[model samples]
Target chain A: MKPQSLLVPALVAAIALLVMTDPAMAYLDPGSGSYFFQLLLGAVLGCSFALKIYWRNLVSFGRRLFSKSRANRPSEQQDGPE
Target chain B: MTGINEVKGSFRDPAGRMFRRDGVLYRGIAPQGLDDYSMLMSSGLYEELCAAGKLIPHEEAASPQAPTDELRFIRPREIPFISYPYEWCFEQMRAAALLTLDVQQAALARGMCLKDASAYNVQFVGPRCVFIDTLSFARRQANVPWAAYGQFCRHFLAPLALMSMRDARLAALLRTHLDGVPLDLAAKLLPKRSRLKMGLLSHLHMHAYFVKKFSSGGAAASSKNTRTLPRNALEALVQSLRSAVLSLKSDESSGEWTDYYDNTSYDAAAMDQKIRIVADYLSSKAPAVVWDIGANTGRFSQVACEAGAYTVAFDIDHQAVQRNYLDALRSGRGNLLPLVCDATNPSPPLGWALAERDSLTARGPADAVLALALVHHLAIANNIPLESICDFFGDICRSALIIEFVPKDDPQVVRMLSMRADIFDSYTPERFESVFSRRFAIERSQRVGDGPRSIYLMTKR
Candidate 1:
């Protein structure tokens, strides 16, 4: 699935998790809002990044399978012509 | 501390404070900053950044009289003229933002992260932006989201988005918001279409939402949860921000004065003669620094730069400054800096106690000033008296002034007069020379070709 499709659900889940979590224990006040936002966004981006990697791997796997089938057919045609 | 004067703006970071002694700049690192300072040096980050020209190079100096609390002292190379973000055009600000990110990434590569991402930490030394605050880095902690994420968003991303999507003039907002434009305000001002941009959505709109949501609850609502961010995720987040910044492009349509040189009243021969005359004056004086006020697209400012003087080309029009900056970058003119400044109301001393940033005049006493074809606008258009103008120039330039006097009968002046009543009875060449004579002595005077306009090279009295 596309990253955009996963965004709303990820956002909702993060917000829910944020609501349930205890008050933050930050040493440096990067600003309460900014710190929280970074956490929430970091999770969403992480998921999307993982999905992108998986998607790339799946595409490469499919491409290899198709190329192997084509190569077998070319050899069979050569054997018939000989 | 006896002879050293602490730089006021440097006190914000307790890690170290920049001070000047005997007219040389130095950074005093307190005992608290020792660990980070040592790490910054030993981790090879310092050498890498210095070699890349991303950071200002400094040398450790022995100062026996250094403050008792200071553990070490290092002197940084001085920038010719210190310019604030408010004076920067859209492209210049964008360049600074990208440079900040680049430095942060480089720091993260070596188990370090920027402690703070303030725009003030970045400064332009010519056309290139360099991260000036050597003490801004800290050892990176595992599973901690970049601590300066919010600040980076506020200082760089917000203003850039507003400028690119809304209006270029919105950059002046930095002058008021010295810390950087508030994220909430930036979110409000941005066009609705910006919400469609994923980077803008997460970094700006949603970021502002969280800030407002948590602001009222204070520290109680602050992030108490220890959410772990994988190193890959953190890198991805920074990459996202970089993409956001890269996506922003300034409106480069020719501004009112961007094409000024092409449409000027002077013929080609007259323009050439004026260039030669200005070049002659600059070469003869050999001033170390030159300020070209009313430098429209920096035509004559180039002459000053080519003469081997560090030149600051200031113009009121944002487009003009933007064009001039791009040209400087393309030509690799390390001696030229183009900034937006309204001569009538130049940048004033700003920030805490009004000492954090230097005003235009406070930064100057430049070796020479080029006021070519500028007096009439100040005199006739702005209604500033010639004496006051002369006084202003005298206060800013130390040695020489190459100024042009446009007679009332000149086509440009005539056009300006046509729109408004010609009440400038004292705006004559004779009045100009007499009034200016109080501050400067006329060393040479030559008319541009046969035009009614005359250029004067004056020595300050």
Candidate 2:
């Protein structure tokens, strides 16, 4: 996938981290570290969702091409006299 | 995800739209909605209701700039948390229903009325019921039918009647019937004797009858002329409904899991020792939150809370949770919150797409967990393996386990084993330690007096 698609999810993860890791708290435990990693994993998973949308558009484009061919191949069969 | 953006519940009157952006929640009040909103606010009703804690307090939009296409935003006071009706127990729902009527009476005095009566509009702030939907108010039609009557019956009356007569467990029926349970179905499930009571006969039993009878025959099609009731009569009807609803009482007894503390095999010496062990463990680990699983009336949660830890006193028994919650409220205990939870099947993630709300597990991995008298049920009754149970706990918390291991000869385990085949071949104290030692280090363990049960304070490795 392109880097462009990954940008939104990466930003979301960074924002989530920033909100959670504010200066007021004590030292981070293993659990918080695990959760931070989970955020990044969530971003990677989010990229697949974006890819699926693009894939669907590509499939629809191919289907349109096939349908156009079929329409052209069946030309003038229903032409009517005046 | 769903209904988060779309306007739902009582807010339907104002073009059915309310939303929260960033942290600010807002409602759209159209020009048509303004008259009712103005009357509700200006007629001293808003102040009266807000003071009584009947309505959620809201301030005017911070800026004089009206909401428009270019910059459509109006900030209203935000609710801290939004709880669902299904999560509410019987008393909570009852309180909300009463509060709704109280608000209605206040609105009526101001020459306005509530356009909706959806239970979803109510949320609990501490122990009090506060109305969350500010846009539900509308100008009272002087001689017209109660606009929210049918909704009130479906949302509050039906569920309350069911809980009052059948079983308190029937309160969970709200999860299935999101729009509120059908009144007709409620009437049928209710005992035949319930129909004998005047309130039940009129509100639920006869109310269902008329609704079905009229709808089936399309009686409204026969006449274009509208039937209207006077404003005073409408107020009277509201009062009567309130009185009727309040009269319904739960015939269901306390939850079956009572007497857990009494039935425990611990003597006074052992109990004191166990409490001391837990208190010491708390001092060392110093967790902010503690979940006392199987915490019957919060005997142990109190110990943790006193140690400066916020305790969630969790128990399967409804009565235990009710008592715990009431005690916390009465004592003004800010650090303790009691919740009814079944360990085998805990509170699932509810609401739209299941992501909008957190489940018991999603909400937790508590700072620590107190599993006293809880392991046996998971082992004997539920047929869960000890290793699996240990792993589940390990996944949920960082450190500390205040747990008890009841031997096979223990009365509770014996009873659980009596009805079933003796399939638990490994249900021994030695085996319990060995299995748990795989994931948790046994920090401390002491057999409680002459009793076969042993309380262990284990730290997750």
For this target, which candidate reaches the highest DockQ against the unseen true structure?
1
Top model by TM-score, which number?
Answer: 1
Report the error of model 1 at residue B430, Å. 0.9
RMSD of 2: 26.5
Clash list (residue pairs), candidate 1: A23-B224, A24-B223, A24-B224, A25-B224
Q: Per-residue CA lDDT of candidate 2, range A38-68, in tens?
A: 2332333334444654576578778999999
TM-score of chain B of 2: 0.78
Candidate 2 residue pairs in clash (backbone atoms < 3 Å): none
Worst 10 residues of 1 chain B by lDDT: B220-229
DockQ of each: 0.32, 0.00
